[model samples]
Target: MRLPLISAFGLALFSLQQVAGITPPPGAESLTACSDVSVRKEIRSLSSDEWNTYKSAVEGAKGDRWIDWFGYLHERVSTKIHGNSEFFLYHRKFISDYEKILRGYEPNVVLPYWNNMIDYQNPAGSPILGEKYFGGNGVTDKCVSSGIANSWNFTYLGNECLQRNFGEADTIVTWYSPEFITSILQSSTTYADLRAGIENSLHGIVHLSIGGDMNTMHSPADPIFWLHHSNIDRLYAQWQAVEPDTRTYMYDGKDYAGNDVTLDDKLTYTSTPAYEVMRLGYGNMCYTYDTIQTANGDENALLSKRQRKCKPRPSKATQTIQKLPAKVLADFYPSFNKKKFSALENEMSDITPKQPMAADCSKPFTPPKPSEKMRGKMPYPGTLSKEYIKMMNLNSEEVRSAEKRAFAMIDELNAANYLSPYLFDLE
Candidate 1:
């Protein structure tokens, strides 16, 4: 499905986050100043006092505006700033600004919790976190009674921090996978299908009745999810450096489900303009990989070149050890295909592994019917037919038209400078 366009005001908000050094459209100069690294450093370093200060900023009548600002920033990064130059030169700057801001207050003040099911052997009790917040004792027996597990399903908390504290600054600890690494691996192999297969084989998480697999339920409530995603974003940046030609990951112009989906198709919302989703989403946007990191830690060189010198000495172990070069445990898993590594190696020897190319548009694009179970809740609102549209008190044509307008507005916004904070001078 094509994406919806944004409103003029939304476009303006998007422009403020851009910062490309290349010559953008008229008035794009404003976009060039938005993604300040200093801003990121400050957010990363935020201390209790700084948080309190920021809280005060939100506590005032206009405090909610800050939330809106973050929302806008998320949308800008997700949708606009298409292509690699924009991805590296602009989007990275915005994330850097956020990181700098976080680091500015307390560089060491890491997000304390990660997924909810980590070795709870010695579960650390917290006044704010734990079964108390969800109304259970910290013990496994009491955890379910509190409604902590599966409560914040699909929120960031599920992805990163495992504990929950209702509305307070509470945290939860849980076990989860790293999505960024999975994405990288999935790019080359059928990782998504494997993930589904694995989750299905396990019959999903032990107690959670939310999303069956860990991936579908990831949200921002868990603080660690952000850091994990940040690292994923860094990997995307790193990948861009190594595979300069592999900017877009779509093959056959269709999504994994074999439905026609362009990179921009993922950006649009059927009903609303989806500015908020854009700010936080980061799904569809033009971006090239950033300069690769060399073995010497230099940015902008070929990553493969660095990999050559850093190749490991072969071991005699029967099981192949896929080289997971990244530091994080999550990053390491997807690098080697455990199931098909032997076949993959043979293929790699004969052919240059190419990412899936876009769809062959010469053929007709057919519309498929939605499954029975997918009727009430479709990923995109527009996926349903006229019958579903009537149930929602809307016409399919009107929805389609609205979405068309939204997509146009988004493009205009990008062209105008809504993503200024992302761009930076390459020099």
Candidate 2:
């Protein structure tokens, strides 16, 4: 007996209906399986060229050195840490949503080609891999090969590589000090400084994901950086839901390199507003955390409500207490902070707080005063050395020309059919 066939239009309509009604089972929303069906479908449809172009834009050099650091860090940290499906599932969903945004406007966005030149150890192998690529003077072929892998270990260490390169080892070590973590955990340091440190650290991750060098644009490195960052963006969104006061936790604003990023300033996936990025991923992104527990029994009810909204409840496989790590009890266990954030707050401001704006243009702008701690002999950990700066910044015109060449190379990759497979498939 022959089976009746359904028309493509009818089949598509049927599939849409199935997705429209799909809902997460109680307490299962945190798992990857519970991700919105439509979002996943959208991600699956992206073209390869589109994905590579976006990757190139991020990986290619243009602005500050820290930007490259952030791109590189994303590559390393994601590769190192994405082994666990628990967190990776969340990342998958985030990728689905974020890619949807880009695909809507730029249907050709595809993942970059990941390059592992050092693994093969051929100076002529990688088009963009060479001592001169990064504008550094005389880095031996051996150092370039080892540096690529070691620098891209992913997770927190990825950022460390940038710190080491930027000469911020002393500053990072100081902040990584037990006392510093304690001060941050206790809220005594104020939220402003805390955010600055986290942003600095994460920017390193971004750099690692792309490349330490500005010449390399969208080479085939890892395709997962976009989804990984989408998860980071989701975390920022969750922090916004904390409360009105908490949303403004870092209202003070900050200055890095030559740019000042304020709380009101929007983050983007591709030079667009973050809110637009959020919408691009989907109208809504459902994410559940590991868990949260309250110290005070009185606060339990309030805490539970917030926890239910954000993270998943304990599974039958694990004890409830284990899943819900107590925030107040962080001092007792060091592992909690290392594995995941004990108290995940949004980035803080480093500059003085801005007062309410008046309608009069004649009114002078007054920046907030620095904290007493900030005023003290502040350490410069990861700043580029004078020698390093002189080496990379040889001629401003030359650097600009090199960056332009990098952009053109990425454009060629997009024109080629290289980035298609990675745009949709999770693996």
Candidate 3:
């Protein structure tokens, strides 16, 4: 069955764009210099006061229907920004605009991103999905019963309760890992490559896995939308910081019409020039992600790189112990094979390593090399079909290529037996 990557309610809202004017568009309102910068951090890292401050502001916006308004506006404009060069620039502006609204309630309030890469293995069980956070999957006909958005109702495209429908037998499939994302960040030297790498992988997977409103173009109706996009923006900013001299202003790629993109490209709904948002610490773009923040005077590196290295060392037992065999891994690690592999050890999936491979510390770990079998299986929800490609103006060939690279990263991590930094160890 062909999946509908586009929203079910994509009714154009040319007028709805006028509602989110916390920061005015480049054409009409004169730009103001930002004296203070808001720091966007991971949601789990927020302090009590910080979390409450953000929550209160979000609640205020939802009460005033700004959340639904953003949803409707996105419903109208998703196609233009997605699957092209404008993906990064447009969302940078769109998310910052929402942040301004939240700041209207509390000036100090900043948007918090969910470092979703760590939770790839079991997104359903992540703490961010608990009632204390965004709540978990819906019960009673897929209606969310917990989280800040549990009782939230929306009037955009008719009233409906907030929802999240996980994929693959009612559970969210595995997401892209940090190692994979880091590879994309490190390896992608151009804007177009970076755009393809992200848009085709975790960016789409999270939206699909958290189905319902999240599955649609009108996804801003759900609170997770902001956090997810915030993380996306964080990645972009981190990429820019990689080489501050050249990449900070780098914007190249084809648009939906197959024309080369430029820094002057106008964002569809807001009519803002793309260059206005190319950099993150000035004008309307005045926020820096925690990961992109400087560490010990290193101004041009991501904090993730500055503080920690991506290469994980195996435990003594791991080096001496055997590695998992391909078939045994397929049976135990459903994520390796998605739906096709038999879930024979479903009960002990995370904990039990059935038939461990012999530890061969002598052999050098191989870089991510996705085999033909690995390339064939991806998150079922992460499908960008031909119809979706046409709707989003995505290049079909580029999509296939991007998926291969993403899958290759997955294969590499599996081959290395990389334990997710996000998962907890129970002894």
Cα RMSD (angstroms) for every candidate in the order listed? 20.1, 22.1, 13.8
Q: Tens digits of per-residue lDDT for model 2 on 1-427?
A: 1111223453344334323444422332332322222211011112233324453443332122324345444344333222111122233334544444444444444322211211111212222222212211112321233322223322322332222121122111111112222223333233333333322323222333233332122211223344334434433333432332333223333322224443233332223222222211132433222111121111233223422343222212112112333442243223333443333331111111121211122443333222333221222112222333243222234333333332333333233322211111112
Best by lDDT: 3
Query: How are the candidates ranked when ordered by TM-score, highest leading?
Result: 3, 1, 2
| Alpha carbon lDDT of each predicted model | 0.27, 0.28, 0.63
C-alpha RMSD between model 1 and the true structure = 20.1
Expressed as tens digits, the lDDT of each residue in 1-427 for candidate 1 is 1112233343334333221222332322232222211111112123334344432332331222322333345443433332111222232344334433443444422221112221111122322223322223222312223422323222222322233222112222221212212333334332222222222211122112121121223222222233333433443433322222232231122232345433233332222121212222122222221111121132223223433343222222112123322222222234343333322111111111011111123432222222333222211111223543342233345345433432343343333323211112222
Q: Which clashing pairs does model 3 show?
A: 321-359, 322-357, 322-358, 322-359, 323-357, 323-358, 368-412
| lDDT (Cα, tens digit) per residue for candidate 3, span 1-427 | 1101112121112112212223333442344434555567677645456677888999999999999889989888877788888898888888989998988988778888887875666688777888778888877667788988877888875677888787666567777765456556655779998899888877877887788788788889889999999988888877665555567667788886679987667887666787688766556776665544432132233222412332223222222112445553343333333432111111111211111121123432332222234321333225555655665556788778777766655555456554433334322
Instruction: For model 2, give the 10-residue run with minimal summed lDDT.
Output: 349-358
Say which candidate scores most in TM-score. Answer: 3
The alpha-carbon lDDT assigned to residue 312 of candidate 1 equals: 28
